[model samples]
Target: MATPIPPPAVTVEEILAELDALDDPKMRAVNERHGNDIGVNLSQLRAIAKRLKTQLEFAQQLWATGDSQARLVAILISSPKKYTAEQLDTMLRETRVPKVHDWFINYILKKNPESESRRIPWMDDVDEFVASAGWALTSHAVAQRVENLKIAELLDAIEAEMKLAPDRLQWFMNECLASIGIHYPKYRARAIEIGERLEVLKDYPTPPNCTSPYAPIWIHEMVTRNEGASEVT
Candidate 1:
C-alpha cells in the first residue's frame, strides 16, 4: 500500500500570516454592514478556522493579539468546552466591538457548559455587553427547552427590569419572552401578556412579512406557527 503523507501542522505565525494576506476591501464593506468594520470576510475566517481546527490554547493566543477579524477567527477555532467562566468573563469584558460581542456570545458563550451558570450573574452585571450576553443566552436556552430553567424568574426579570434595561439588553429580553411563548405553551399566555405590557420595539422598523420584535406580535406569530405545525402533524 502507498504511504499517506500527513498534513503539515499549522502554527500561530502561519495563521497570522494567512489572516494578513486575505484582507479584502470588498469584504470589509460587507463586514461593515454586519457591524464588523474589520477588513476580513466570513469565508476567510472560516477557512482559517478550518485549517487551525480546534486549538483552544492557540486560539487564546490568537485572541489575545488580533484585530476584529482575527479575534473572530480565534473565537471560531477555540473550544468553548475548555473555557472557564472567569476566562469567558474576561473575554466578554474585553469585547469593544459589537460584532465580536455578538460572535462571542452566540458562538462561544452559548455553547459553553458555564453558560447557564453565568446567565443570571451576567444579567446582573452593569456592563452592557455582559448583560446583553446574559439575555441572549437566556433566549437561546428557553428556545431549546433547557431543563430546570426558571421560566418564572425570567418572567419576573422581564416584568421588573425590561423597561429599564439597556437598549441592547431590552431587545434580547424581548426575545427571551418570545421564546417562552413559542416553546412553553404553559407560559405562552403570560409571555404574550408581558410583551403587550412592555410594548418593546413596537416602533422599530421591520421588513414586510417579517416578525416584529414587539413581544405580542412576535409571540402571536410563533404560537400561530406552532399551532399550524401541530395540526399538520
Candidate 2:
C-alpha cells in the first residue's frame, strides 16, 4: 500500500470547534451527575487527540483554554516526559472538572517519571482532590508492586481514614485497600477485616454482573478471577 498523507496540523481554535461540535446535552447531564461538566464523549475526544498526535505546544494551548474537553485532548497529546513535577502539580490543581482531573492523573502523572515521587506528598496533601490523586497513584504503585510501599501502613491509613474521608478521597482510599488485598496474599485477611469493619462503600449499588466497590467484595471477586486464570494457565 502507498503511504498515506498525514492530515495538516489544526490550530487550537479548530480543535475547540471540533470539541464544541461533539458536545451533547444528554451526555453533559450524565457527566454532570458524576461531577464532570464536559459533554464530549471520551472516545471521540481521544480520536481527536489521535489526529493531533503528540504536540506539546498545542497541548499547552488547549490546556490554557480551561475547557475540560480541550484539557482532555491536551493530556492525550502531551508528552508525559516533558512535564516537571511543579508543572504537573499546577495542571492538576487547575483541573477542577472531575474527568479532566482523572485524565490528567492517568494520562500524564501516572506516565511521568516523577509519578512515584509525587504519590506520598500528594496523599499527605490537605486538598481532598489532590489527596485522592495521591491515593490513586499509590493504588497504581501497589498494583504494580513498586518497592517498599509499606502495605501495612497503607492498610492502617485506610482503616483509620476511609470511612470519614470525603467522597472522592474515600473512593481512592478504598481502591488502595482493595488493591493491597488483591495483590498481596499475606495481607488479604487483614485487608478484608478492615474493609468489613469500616463498611465503606458497602451499600453502593452495583449493576447486575458488576463487582461491588466494597473492598472485601471487590477483593474476593478479583482474587477469584486471578485464581481461575491461573488454573487455566
Candidate 3:
C-alpha cells in the first residue's frame, strides 16, 4: 500500500489569507440579505476547508478572534465530536447573527454526539441563541428519525410553553412540533391536536405549491406525502 499523505499545516494567518482571496462584494451583499454579512461564499469556505483539512484547535483560535468569514470557516473546520459542552456554550454565546446561528446548529451542534444531551437543557436557557440552538437541534433529531424521542414530553411542552417561548425559538419549536406529528405515528393525533390548538404560523405566507408552516397543515401534508411514497414503493 502507498504511504498516507500527511495533511498540510494550516495556520490562522493562512486561513485568513484564503478567506481574503475569496471575498466578493456582490456575494457579501447577498449574504447580508440572508443575515450572513460574511463576505465569503459557501463554496469558497468549503474549498478552504478542503484545502486546510481538519484542525480543531486552530479553528477554535480563529473563531475566537476572527471576523464573520473566519468564524464561518472555523465552524466548517472544527470537529464537533471533540467539542465539550462548555466550549459549545461559549460559541453559542458569541453567536449574534442568524446566519452564523444557522451554521452552528446545522454543521456543529446537530452533528455532535452529545446533541440530544445538550438539547433540552439548552432550550431552558434564557439566552436567545442557546435556546434557539436547542430547538434547532430538536428539530434536526426529529428529521433524522432518532429513536426514542419523548413525543409526550414534547407535546406537553408545546401545550404549556410554546406560546411563550422566546422570539427566535418559536420557529424551531414549531418545526419540532410538526416533525413529531409527521414522523411519530403513535403521537400523530395528539401532536395534530396540539398543533390545531396552538395554530403556530397560521398566517405565515407560503409560496405557490408550498405547504404552509402552520403546524397542523404542515404535519398533515408530510404524513400524506409519506403514505403516498410508501404506496408507490
Candidate 4:
C-alpha cells in the first residue's frame, strides 16, 4: 500500500516572525505602498506580513499534498481589510483546524509569477472580486502617500506665471502687508516725514540743554513721538 504524505510545515506565527525580521527600508517600502493609515514601523509591518505569509504558504503546501483545507483561503483574500490584528492573533493562538490557517495565508501571499492574477481557490468571479477589493483598499491607503502629479503641475504653472507677471507679485506683497497690518500709504508717507524730522533733530546737541523730562517717573516714555516711533520701529 502507498504511504500517507506527511502534514504540511510552516505556521502562521513563524511566517509572521520571519516577515518581521526584514530590514527597515524594505518593510517601509511595502507599507508606503499597501499599508493602511496605521503607519506601523518597519519591524511591525514585517512581522505582520511574515505571519500572514506563513499561513498562506502552509495552505498551498497542504493543497499540493492532497488536502481540502484550501477552502479557508477564501476567508482572508475575500476581505483582508475587514480583519483586525486581535482577530488574527486570536485565530492563530487558538487554531485547532489543520491547514486552514495555511490555506488562508497562501491565498493572501500567493500570486501568479507570470500573470497579475491571484489564486481565488473558488470561481473566476470570486478571485476577481477579492483582487479588486484588496487592491482598492491598499491603493486608497497608498494614494495618500503619493504626490498628486496633476495638481502639483497646476500649482507649479501658477507659480511660474506669478514669476513672469509683476502685477501678481505686487498683489501678493500687498496682501501679505494687509495680513500683517502694514498700511502701505502710511508706510511710505511716514518714511518721507521721518526724513524731515530727523534733519531737524540732527541740529540738536547730543547733550540736551534740559535734563529728564519726567523727574524719575518715566524718563523713556517722555521722548517725543517722532523720536519714540523712530527708535521703536
Highest-scoring model, lDDT: 2
Task: Pick the TM-score winner.
Answer: 2
lDDT of each: 0.84, 0.90, 0.83, 0.32
Query: Could you give the C-alpha RMSD of every candidate to the true structure, in order shown?
Result: 2.9, 1.7, 2.5, 26.3
lDDT tens digits, residue span 81-165, model 2: 8898999888877877888888888889899988778889999899988998999999999999999889999988888888899
Q: Write the per-residue lDDT of candidate 4 for residues 33-136, one digit (tens) a residue.
A: 64211223534443443444434435433334322222242233234434444433333333233234333433432222211222111112223233322232
Could you give me the TM-score of model 1 versus the true structure?
Answer: 0.85
Error at 5, model 1, angstroms:
8.3
Better of 1 and 2 by lDDT: 2
Per-residue C-alpha lDDT of model 1 across residues 1-233, encoded as one tens digit per residue: 99855434777677677877878988778778866767766777787777667778777988888477778988988888889988998999888788899899988998898878888899889898888888999899888888899999889989899987877878888889889888888988898888777788889899998988888888888788878999999
lDDT of 2 at 30: 86
Q: Candidate 2 or 4, higher lDDT?
A: 2
TM-score to native of every candidate shown: 0.85, 0.94, 0.86, 0.18
Clashes of 3: 0
- The clash number for model 1 is 0
lDDT of 3 by residue, 133-167 (tens): 88888888887887887778877887888887766
In angstroms, give how far residue 61 of model 1 lies from its true place: 1.0
